[model samples]
Target: MTADHKIHKKDPHYQQAKRERYRARSAYKLLEIQKKFEIFKRAFYILDLGCAPGSWLQVSKKFAEDNLTKYKDQYYHRDHYVILGVDIKKVSKIENVQFLQNDFTKPEFHTHLESYFQTKIDLILSDASINKTGNNFSDHLRQINLCLKILELAEAHLKFKGSLVMKIFQGADFKKMFEKAKSVFRILKAFKPQSSKKTSNEIYLVGLQKK
Candidate 1:
């Protein structure tokens, strides 16, 4: 292996992801969430915002594959399931996923999303984060803003019973964000996957069955 690969392999999650053919170590985070909540139980159309390096897309595909028998009766009539990813930066191709390279903060991006799906989505996952500037407070505020944007998109595009999982830094604005999530979703939860680095303040907010 090359030196870079050697270094990456030393990380347990990275090694496991390599062995499992996942795109990145972060795949395990979504997998853990699935294990705890069964978020993909009946999902047919899914979206991944800020999916770069595409690990979450990999996890979504794997979940669909593994649960095919269970969800087939509910979704099999569809000619094809939709798994779309959007990011500001280009992502390497992954089979069965359509990716759009666009900044999601722009209003026009919603048009692209609606045109592609042509229907409300069943699940939306966002692991988007602002570049950390070493100032925790500023970083937290930026991430909170990003989470609110994701919530706006979800409100506009998610089906009534659909779900969302998004990452946000836990700081001053977290409770406000959580309350906003509660207003939009019948069930709201905060989760931190074991795969997440212990030192990181990032937590996932899950909103289920949008109101």
Candidate 2:
């Protein structure tokens, strides 16, 4: 086997993801977040930004299906649950989720989103990150900028009382992004899931109840 494959095989999360049939180990990050916060609770219309390799999409589909089954008797139209994923990179198909390949930072992306789901989204997730350039500071800045863009999209597209979970690299401007999120959300918290690499500075900003 290749050296990288060997390394990945030894990683516990990678092995677990294989066993669970998830596309990537990153699925565990969302799983841990859901376990802690129940962010998917009552989320019918969902959007995933920068969703390539679709591990998060898998978790979302499972959660939405479970929610539908649990509350099957409550709603007459139980057939609809909108889960859309957007990425600059082309993602392979997932059975129940929709994938759109477009630059989410562009204005035209909104037009595409509007065409798919008429109502505001109940939850917005962004696992968006810049390709690491080996310079931590520069990488952090780029990631924070990406997070801010996701926040802007959330502010415009999220339904009132909706939730947003976005990944951001902790850096000097981390507090600035936190403050921005605070202004837009009623409740905001920074979380690092155990599945995240211990050496990585990435953290998820969970924003609840859009105001």
TM-score of each predicted structure versus truth: 0.92, 0.95
Give the TM-score (vs. native) of candidate 2: 0.95
TM-score of 1: 0.92
Give the top-scoring candidate (TM-score): 2
Which 10-residue window of candidate 1 scores lowest in summed lDDT?
70-79
Candidate 2 Cα errors over 4 Å, as ranges: 72-78
How does residue 39 of candidate 2 score in lDDT? Answer: 97
lDDT of each: 0.89, 0.91
For 145-207, candidate 2 gives per-residue lDDT tens digits of 888889988988999999999999999999999999999999999999999999899999999
Backbone clashes for every candidate come to 0, 0
Distance from true location, Cα of 22 in model 2, Å: 0.4
Q: What lDDT, from 0 to 1, does candidate 1 have?
A: 0.89
RMSD values for the candidates in order, in angstroms, are: 2.3, 1.6
